[model samples]
Target: RSDPSSFCIISRLKIIKTDISLDGTKKVLFELEDGNRIESVLIPEKNHFTACISSQVGCAMGCKFCLTARQGFIRNLKSSEIINQVIQIRELLDQPEKLTNIVFMGMGEPLANFEAVKKAVNNIISPDALNFSRRRVTLSTCGLVPEIERLGKDLPINLAVSLNAGDDKTRNMLMPINKKYPLKKLIDTLKNFPLHKGRRITFEYILIRDINDRLSDATNLARLLKNIRAKINLIPFNRYDGSPFEEPDEKRILAFQDELIRKNYTVTIRKSKGADISAACGQLITGP
Candidate 1:
């Protein structure tokens, strides 16, 4: 007979509500065991779906543009809580296998909860568990330098850095973490990060009007990442209540992308999805 103590019991997160955007992006609100809530997004792609999961209940990084930061830091989720998000979201799809990609860009800084995230990633890619391809899993961080170094050694999964500004002064105004890591030091770390052949690190730059959206900022960005193998994702700022930023005009956005493309950098403008339901990037927050 098996000992009861030897069996591990996993408590599931309750699905409190779900909101679907016209674009087919579904945002799920989950109630944790302690009644604290977190949200996840199911993004429908060309052929597959990507699950954007959260590593922490709320965020401590305090980026000026993020709504999640307004809630302040709650607690780091357990590895089971993190993995269960993917599992439950996948279960909602008609063809679960189509849910292939997993991105840690939902609510909090993933590296802030490194150990739990590492354990979750191991299970996410383990053949006997969730069995996801390493290439399809991406973890986005707000320039957590030491954790970024540790992550490279601990997991070979895809990495995406939220680099909203090219210079230290502007970055410090946007993400408070920049004050500690700074732009030069952070770039230096990324320059030495281990990447598999043909795999480039993704730099997520949120383009905010009159802030980090100027032509000079784009040039500085190009110069800053000149040495690293990088692909840029230009995200137009998604405005929420009380946000002090606005998205740049379409022409300005194009010019920003063009500057990078002219410099021989791969760039893509990430379309704002689920905004109608308040599920777009940096728009996630729990409670009414």
Candidate 2:
């Protein structure tokens, strides 16, 4: 037998609690060793489930529309902590094989914790490890330009950019990171990103009421992404307590989608899921 004192076994994340939404979405709260907590969401798709995992305890990028930003930046998670999220979530599934897709759209910015995310992603897609297909794994970012370039080179997984606004002024008001890397620089980087055959970059636009939901905004968005191979996902703003934003009405939402379709761009309106449990996009946050 090996020497027991050589190394100590680090404990995995403890599951604090799980909240299931009316629509079948499951939100799992995990407590880390340091007593900090993070959330991971299990979203039920047509035939499979998608796990939205966190890369950081809290977020540094203070996007006005995101609830996590309210918590401020805490720290980046270790690679093991990142990968453990997937392992733990999978174990909780009755049919674990049904969990097919993994999205880094939870609490923290994945690119902010680049090294750990890269390591976790490598393990995620490695045949001997998690065995997840690269095509099924997606990482979402709120426009971290340099990290975006680096990610393109290091990882070949699907990319989803959170492009909530069409113009710089509106974007600046929504996502503060836009102040450093403006819209022009972001679009240019995405245009140069290498993609495998039939793969297109996904642009996520959160349509907040009377803010970035106008038909003109949609027209501007179409112009902004004209040259890139892109598919747009229009996510209506998900509201939370003390949030200053509201979701646009269905009429306005469809009008925005119509404008993009009229411009020959493929778009889908993402249905707000798990809002009852606060597990929807931009609604994840953990207490200090």
Candidate 3:
């Protein structure tokens, strides 16, 4: 009765569907006001949880292995939409405060929607908001060079590059953006990024069988990233229907990681999670 119209009410996105995987991964699909949909995944760790959020409804970069790219460009998500993903996921957990990590690896290239993505990051780390640690928040991009440089200048958060291919020709085939920035230029930009002490940029390399999984590819990748303080996350390709690539055998994937370790590079093979529900890396495609 006390001036109800005076109070502001922000509209929340509608949750279209929720699915829990056998591995305990939870995916929530939210419908935007304009009818476009974006999905976020809540991944539980040993004691904490990580929220993988999206920055765009669909992707424009056209990474050959990504399902979101197949949806093409719908539009950039609003900062509110991006921030709401974390909030909604946090609300789903038993110990909400333990959701300690956030990754911008769900649907689109975060750096492509630079301004909104930056605003969302600020809100996520702000004391009045989610109150997340800057170190615990990682933003992934597909090497949008200028935007990447700007992000480094504006924020101290962790950065991850979706570097699926080691060389230009192969990279150009897998990710079209490589043709614009190229490997050398992108590496140079990252090398010059202002990273804090004890922190290394993360490079995500997805290994496709007979494509970018050869030992020579690992050697070239090791050489390319030697100058930069970086750790490698090797993802054995997660395949979907109509997808041309195949995930490498476990032995081949480990051999690739060992080659990097022998070269004195820190590497980890990312275990594919939620494959049954298509909620793993490069698999967040929203259905009509």
User: How does each model score on lDDT?
Assistant: 0.93, 0.92, 0.89
Query: Candidate 2, overall lDDT?
Result: 0.92
lDDT of 1 by residue, 1-288 (tens): 122123343777899999999999999999999999999999999999999999998999999999999999999999999988988898899888889899999988999999999999998888767889999999999999999999999998999999999999999999999999999999999999999999999999999999999899999999999989999999999999988889999999999999999999999999868999999999999954
In order of listing, the candidates' clash counts read 0, 0, 0
lDDT of 3: 0.89
For candidate 1, the TM-score is 0.96
For candidate 1, the 10 contiguous residues with the lowest summed lDDT are 1-10
Please give, for residues 129-165, the per-residue lDDT of candidate 2 as tens digits. Answer: 7888999999999999999999999999999999999
Candidate 1's displacement at residue 263, Å, is: 0.7
lDDT, residue 114, model 2: 98
Residue pairs in clash, model 3? none
Model 3 per-residue lDDT at 161: 93
For each candidate in turn, the TM-score is 0.96, 0.96, 0.96
RMSD of 3: 3.5
Model 3: CA > 4 A from native: 1-9
Lowest summed-lDDT stretch of 10 residues in model 3? 1-10
